[model samples]
Target chain A: MKSTYLALILVLASAPLWARTTPEELAEHPRWKALLHINQGTTWRYQGRSYIDDPDFFLHESGATDARAELEASIEQLRSSESEARCDFPARYRFLSQQLDWPDDGALSHCSEYQEWRGAMPEERVALIFPASYLNSPSSMFGHTLLRIDHGEDEDGVWLSRAINFGATVQGQENSILYVYRGLFGGYPGYFSNVPYMNKIRDYAHLENRDMWEYQLNLDEQEREWLLAHLWELEDIEFDYLFLDENCSFRLLELINLARPESGLMNDFRLAEVPANTVSSLDRAGFIESVDYRPSKANELDALVKQLDATEQDLALALAADHAVTEREAFRELEPRRQNLVARTAYAHLRLQNREGERSQAAAERGMALLRTINGTPTVSGIEPERPVSPEKGHGTKMLAAGGGMLGDRGFGELQARFSYHDWLDNPDGYLNGAAIEAFNARIRRTEGDDLTLEQLDVVNIKSLAPRNSFRKPVSWFVNGGLDRRFIGEKRHLTRHIQGGPGLAWELGPVMPYAYAMARAENNSAHEVLVSTAAGARAGVLWYADGFQLGLEAEGLYYHNDDRRYRPSATLNVPLGRNHALRARIERDGGPDRAETEFHLSWRYYFD
Target chain B: MRKTLLAAALVATSFGAQASAPGGSGCGWGNMLFEGNDGMPMHVLATLVNGTSGNRTFGITSGTNGCDTSGALSYHGENMLAQAGVMEEVAQDMAVGDGEALTALSVSMGIPAEERDHFKKTMHENFSTIFPSEDVTAEEVMANIQKVMNQDKQLASLS
Candidate 1:
């Protein structure tokens, strides 16, 4: 009996050698295509091999290219030996087995460290956190996205949970200009990092004063486990960061696609992935369960200030000021609740003031003393503002405008469009109010003589109109550049123009008034001088109501070569619906000739 | 005149005891050197970082940057970060007597929701002692809180 059993074991062991697979046969399998696709492997015909985008994600020698060959080799290796640290084998193994109808042998095994990490990872829930657009920083203008892995109880544990952040690990110090250049042109290598959610909250909510929105993913336990495992597989993997395409938003979408391949989150986002666009895509995939908002310090203070009476607000300011004896005395004379209100308001006011370097050290100390004086006072002023609409709720970022009107004595047909982003009067419901950012805005005109001309091409235009308040004195600003059609006497000529300036803006009831001292430089194509620099002043007032917005501006410019001009403009924006608007603009230019007037009426549509 | 004499005697004896004791010191220069008394250096460092970290008191109030009560517990057991942060919020919402600052303070102190009203009342009544002047430190604020707690049986029991 022993001799017979030995003979049978030898025969069984030799059976797998009889039908070994060729590389060609392995490559033909559908399972191989799926596996290679998930690894982000592409055939480099010139190099005559395949390579994976993330080198660290796969362990097999041919894992980067020739997915079938790698799979067949890995399966053979796994069957032969144990304890190999093929970190990504388990998922591939399971996928191949189920797709190819292979036997359920426990051949694929994880290393001890990988197993330990898997056990330690959260299995219940996942959340996508987006810190909204921070216009102050060039990098975060499109906003940023990260994933939070919930390990404990739902609500409260979110604060202490771990997060996965993918960012470009800049090698050394770079100034803001260099940083932007490097970021846009793939000058930095991006890497994924794991950090606690508290760190992000610190950076966004308090330090940056940007609100955060958390969208809990509707992934089940199995999906969450798969995502967690894949995240671990991607640990320390490096990818060249391209600001436009392979950016934070794009990479996160790719990661999601790995876990839920059927959703194909990365399918339509091959070219560019705006943060809000990616968020909308996730919603479309039916992955988002619910959303939670965490207000920034600025938002909280704004809400709190709205609730305070004028006298209480004054007392609050006085308490924050170092030398306001009269206000302090008046504050003390108030009732207990009022006193607490004044103190709380003062404390909040000082905190915001300190951000702009407006508060002195002594005044700050007094602010703390005022708080301690009213400690435990039961003033229930938890005035959280109603949450803003989600970015997905806003109209699509791209805009198309079409209409026609007259330019001086000529009748013309006009078409204008912008590739991205919001404008101040474009139904500021789901966007940052009073903020406008436009990229690649172009306008083309057709004259009555059937001549098509490019009127303007704006490379970038960003305007931030932050209104001043009692607590914050922010300097609003504008920056714009590109080719513009300026009327030189009677004919229109395209000029290369770059202009920006710092300005002050104040909100008075429904009208916001602003003034700016601008330095403008332009190179007119049909001018005697190649470049002309001008020092100009512009003042404008914007009156806005429910669905109506009207703006009026007057500007006077003095060029370096004793050329002087004055331009006055007015724009009226009326909302047609949620995603459409009608606008009428009129401008008068006074130069060597009499003032020339250009009027236009256009209809604008915002997409989804 | 009699009271002044007693105060002088008390000061003299206290100074003599501090001078002769082994490793005993005042809070000033000694605290900076070896932290022999008051741990004033650590408190000062905490205060300076808290004020200069570009977050201001709002960072602490919002529980960002680890600016919570657990961190920077001064020698007198006062959470300086919390004290500075809560003051701002308390001053903002004083009329209602309830705000994020007070809520955070209560949560950190393990005060039950039912006892918050009493806690607020005690602090409001003892405000004069807690903040006797505009230059009061977090330690003085905490010490005054303890004194207030001792005088109120409900607060003392809760603490």
Candidate 2:
């Protein structure tokens, strides 16, 4: 009896220490380190109290605190609770349970709702949803990324898969300027929201005309379960929204990294994260298994129109127009095959137009009638274009170019660098055709015996020319605001310029020609030096086949200060490899005082 | 306006008794956007809304279609593509009657609140003729709607 009492006392003494770990030992735990590394407990001042954006994720204490205390407290709670507690992250518990070799009791079975969701979303197959960049929308200019939990549904159920999306929840209505400012800074709180994949299709494919690319990931069931579990943990959790770094793509990468810690997808992105870059990282990590493309309504219509002859195209246009009876008569005259094509094309055209009320109603009814008439025969066929190389297969986002050539008789060495994104003149292979968006692009040149001069510094420049085709006619536009050096007298003067306008473009066979009328203003130390403004017109024609490209552009600038100038330029680009290209350019500038010509040859390298 | 009312009258006449039958359809005007077949008016409306409203239309439209809910009915346990097929069939004629397959679909293709009863009445009246049996398929429903339209003088004249 005396020995038994002593042994009981010894067992009781060690039980408390086993249940509650020391802060230092808890700090060494891998799960603890993972949570801290992800900024799980990072606190920010909001209103007055310190707020930890991740709601109920850390249960040791409210607000931001030490991870050690949280882990120790969690273990204590776990030991005392009869059932699995609701306060801890299920993934974390699973990790800790394995790390510490805890018993296989039902203590961690609290998350029935989440378990049900997980069962519905089979972890065997997963896909990454990338809504390719739509330059027209400011928010989508950088593109967006989401994760799809594919449950292996049938063809129709494929769209029923659940999607994990992280986006900023705008707190209140604000003006455009304020909204932009808030979006850039941390004024909004970003959160993870789950929805069916079909909704995203409707938004991007049908409404916004942005194509979606699905890249199925090659993760094992274990890795996929980890991803789903972490995503479930992130549900309804808020994170400070920073447009540059902690945006949608960045958060998605972090989530992916949590699943495969050694993959280190987040490490490559330090300051900025682009959706395409993350995709490239996933590819590099050997996560991508296969790729599929879902063409937008506009894409299909564009492709279909190319197959039609001029007469068939005109018939399609008539069917899409408001004259219902005439269009019907014209539609019926075509052969069955032609009729089917025209009816489908007309329907797509009308939908793209998106009219309203009774007139649209009648045209829709009429379009349906045409389709119904053809349904008895055979349906129109949809011929899909060969999917372009995946965005991951494209050249990297960061570009560096170095070359030396004669500039107006002066031998100068020019170095150009672009921090992020694509330019039209660049190889248009893994990007949207006729679309360009660049940030922090600069060109510096040093004369043979002179100091380096900043020839151009563009903060942001975006241009989208969705060429007008028979089926759809969308406005083509360009907006460029930056600083440039203009040759004034004998030297160059730095001038700030803002220019933008809308125009039209058409694709004729292998060549696409475009024109834009723009209002441009340049302030060169306005109060001290030359101040000039111009309403200008620019025309360009581009011919591209395979990987070779040649472009010719002419611009006539009518200045308010009588510095009227006309500039014509031609460019030839040849691709050297997947990530390298050589570009040659020659330009002639004609102004009131004199006429000068310049030439440049540059070798460009891209890095992702 | 006269032409539109006539079309509506023709639809009403055909669908009057069986509008609320199982799998009965609605006006299906909203799908003009979904099917990429909007008329001039719908196209104009879509353009106006797409320009100014951002994704509000997505919220409105998807929510109307039961996309906002987790337990959305599948096309007889079929996948998304099959559900889309059914939607296309329903778009052919919104005025049809109730059936087991269309319960989920009708919720998705919600008519204007005020027009629900009239739309339902139209579907109830046309249900038996459209279905003819309990196991009627979407393709059958579409073919039947096409037949009804073919038989109507006003609709046939326009076609």
Candidate 3:
């Protein structure tokens, strides 16, 4: 009887050790859900299954959709020595081992490849890098975001740090139209790449002339390790690239959220992920540790030119144009400091010109000579470029406005909504000067006793007014296409039209005046043909001050069918705060058959 | 005057041809520098749709994308500046005896902060030798830099 009692006690004592963790329990873990990128939304659905689009990323057949199955398969695969699971999914292995009391049997130590890669890139710190908007490039018009991994500064500093970039793996030599189509519709596979930080600086600051902002992250060491482990597991993984939402910035936020689940970096960025808005979100979430700005080559040259007088600027320009100008009295009469400045400016100009054109022997020789002259003189202290307002300080990307306005003899209440971006009359605190980009802007009006009618719907509108200066003469241009209600004789009809052209703009202090000779193609109900084209001209003056904006514009169009139209408009915007504004606009539209006058005052609110 | 200019051009072309073909080490630095020069259409299109030209490296090798791991001018077993296109910037910075590119190069060479000014001064004085011509390759520039640094007491220890 005593032996039987002892046997029962022994059986009871070993019961807890034999109890195994169920797949359901492991699958329900928060870390497991994060590893699978399982977010609570219909937008993240892929193939009517899970968020991950890549089949290779899953270990089980239904791993993409079935978390419990994936966990079971992962556990089984991890136990086998011949399987690639340990190396292929190190982050999963690390998590599983920590959660379950796995024996220290050298399972992780066998992952030589993962060990080597992890050892090579010891991530002690991370920084979110934002290459600011370059309006000239369509892809960069919204800016770009990436991550830089710093292994605590050695003698080499962070210049050799590794930069993690996620972008579409675009196919070969596609045309612009096809490229845009593929980019918008997820026809391309996006992947994460690791590159040296210096290469990025060279590409952005030197070649593309885009300034970069680096925001150091405050992730703890444990969080950084978790992030790096997940990053390694994503090697060669592909994600469907959607230009608007599932883009580079969005994927970066996913990685960040995986590191600190409580951070919720991806929560409020479901609809649209503007790069600047993401930066603002990071700032709000307290992920930003510090901020640093690196100026572009153009900014550097501009700063240098600002130090010189008008005659000296002319001299520098001459030296850049003609190498023989260096021997002239005008050049030799300057002090050594001034001479150094002129030579530096000339060299920068030559470099910039060479970047845009084929290499010329004469220009190269001139550049070499200028460098020699610069080296012979005593080195001057470098001048720092003026820093503009940071992107996060700008008003949000989406806007909504409500107001009452008069159109001809009718008074109406109008509600306007813009899906994205900045416009000329919007606050220009953090946006590029003289630049405007809007997409999917819609206005609906309700007449005093009538039903609501769509007034206008703009699919895309973009404008860049780069002003001409003594040092740089950039061409200004605008393009817009949309549906608008136009006066056709005595009735208003919806017309589809696209207009664009190139022009020149000059900056007079805070006021910029621009003019464009435009051509338009439209499908109007009143047109004699299905599609009618028109030639027109547009002139505008924009004045930006403290927190206020004013724009005066006029346009004239002559259609192919002998229809003439003239329009003049003025808009004034006053900011109540960063996200609130009051705008007033007045316009007179005159056609060959009829004329109408309209005015409106609106209160606008902006959000991300 | 036109004849003299033509003669100088011919001489430069011949010199360029004779001087050890820029990227003889198979690092393709010259090609990298001239990468986006395929006219405005492609440049505008590529930059418009995708921010990058889609040349990606999955970290299979130690040096991920542009750098050639087998190159002579390597740091931590990976070439730091082989295909970065920063050679021109570095040359300009070297001429001025101070700039961001100069500092980056010094750091890549493992020069300590206290010795960076000396390194920059050394490179500044040797700018002509480092960049003898516009067609000078990154390998040649690196070789020249190492030669000059080897001659300097403070920088020699770091290099």
Candidate 4:
């Protein structure tokens, strides 16, 4: 009788262990934690809390903080036929059923809403769609990333594929300043949205004139299904949108990581996230199976225009400007093929012009006429834009440089660190050429027998040198605001300044030369005036190649206090490899009272 | 049997929602082509924020809400190319006689692989009829495409 009682007790104790997954164990599971978006206490303030900002996402009262209790409550709710947990959290139900070996009671099978939604999307493949940077758009300047859920085997079917995007929700009438301020400080709520891929293409390629790169992932069938299921759970869920770290690219990475937990794509990015850097991370993680490029409409137009001769180009431009040009002798004399090319170019130009602002009725009519003319002729060979190097092949966004150089008369050892993004002299392989966007760039120098001093701190500096041709005339512009060491009278003082202007750039052979008429405001400590404003003009020539870049620039500024300053600089950058480069600069600073010449040579290392 | 019935009911409800008003009144033919343009400040703001102003779609339903279900060209519940921006691309591609947009439209229309070239050719030939005017609605364009497809022996079955 005693032995029987002991055996019975042993069976009861072991039964609890073998029969089901403990709430504690299920709470700590990687997949469960991922579904809940629970951070592993890595982020300082958000440790052990869910990343989801919305309270509705959690089932239990303490669900956001206490995973074990949430799991227990969720299991109870899922098992109860009276509750809507199975329908509301289908992914959780599916996961729990597998883990707990629950009976096939058709509980989840009866989740009609989820079943119908799942039935609609029979996706078997996924690709990461990255729209390259558009300098005209401040938010897109860092580039943007989204996912495309592909169905069927047809290559053309990609246009119909569903795109999953995460972005901030903003009021329609928000001004640009408020938009930037809210985007930077996480004042807006970000949500996941699924739209047709073609809409995204229209927005990125046709409207914004940005090229897109598609990185088809190598996820298997089961993994793809899990991603889709998780995506459903995230429907209508909100997250705090922080531009630096928890932005669009970061959210997409989270989704990809949840799909294949082993990918661990989110482990490295801690401080800030840039869209291009995420592509490099995915490539490093071996998630990319293949890469494809889709050129923008502007690129297509450029290619079409290139195929025409100088005279034909002029005719094409004239035809686009005025549909009446088609009746002219110069247009009438062209061969059928040349006429088709010109007509096609004209149509593309009209479409691009109509993309922004109010569409002129005349432009629309011309577009239709051109299309009709093109349709009447035999179809020529299509134009394919030349693909540049992939974004992953470019140098990393964060840069560190170490060197020593002569500042005025003293020898100084300088350390420069740019928090994010490329400059004109940086390797331009994977980035936009003639465009420079740098944020939080800081330089420190220690002169002979002197303490280390902050040389310069640039909060934001953006330069877009869009070279103009006969076909399209884009204005080149630059804006820079920062603190820099400048000579006020005879002493070097750190001054805060903001300067910007609009200019024009033209490409001549291998070089692009630009000139800008600039306005500036400065707060200088050594200056007699508390705040000094200036009017200035700058001219620069940039010659860039695959492995080397050289720039010569000069500027003259006349301050409100009648002090005049001139600066001329020559910079050369030679990229040794993808991530290493040697840069040298010789600059002369001419002030009202004195002039100083300085030289700097540095080896730069690029990293994410 | 019960699960299937429930699934049917759910699908019916979703379809009902879609049929009633998918994209609300804001999704009209007039707003389709020039939808993104909303004056200089809004345009500049959109460029800077990259946010979809007042767009709150969870992607549960079909992504497109511009399809006119009342039209005869409604195939498979939603017309994939009904969005104005995509319609514009389709019109352009149809004019070219061959392009990605045209091929995508053919695929969406359920045209077989072998019949796609014939469909493209037919659409190319009928570009003027399909896009009668720049202000033509997506429903009209889709109807014209269907009519053109029906006339072609190879693509009639797809229509």
Model 3 alpha-carbon drift over 4 Å, by segment? A1-21, A42-44, A47-49, A80-83, A154-156, B1-78
Task: Quote the positional error of residue A78 for candidate 4 in Å.
Answer: 1.1
Better of 1 and 2 by TM-score: 2
Q: Score the docking of each candidate (DockQ).
A: 0.04, 0.06, 0.12, 0.24
Per-residue C-alpha lDDT of model 3 across residues A357-475, encoded as one tens digit per residue:
34456776778788888888776685779888889899999999999889878899999999999998899988888888899999999987788899899999988887877777778
Clash count list over all predictions: 26, 41, 0, 0
Q: Is the docking of candidate 3 incorrect, acceptable, medium or high quality?
A: incorrect
Worst 10 residues of 2 chain A by lDDT: A41-50
True contacts kept of 3: 0.16
Proportion of true contacts reproduced by candidate 2:
0.05
- The complex in candidate 2 yields a DockQ of 0.06
RMSD of each: 13.2, 11.8, 9.8, 6.6
Scored against the true structure, residue A356 in model 4 reaches a CA lDDT of 55
In CAPRI terms, model 1 is classed as incorrect
Q: Among these predicted structures, which one has the highest TM-score?
A: 4
What's the alpha carbon RMSD for model 4?
A: 6.6
Ranking by DockQ: 4, 3, 2, 1
Comparing 1 with 4 on TM-score, the higher-scoring candidate is 4
Model 4 residue runs over 4 Å out of place are A1-20, A41-45, A81-83, A175-177, B1-78
Docking quality category of candidate 4 according to DockQ thresholds: acceptable
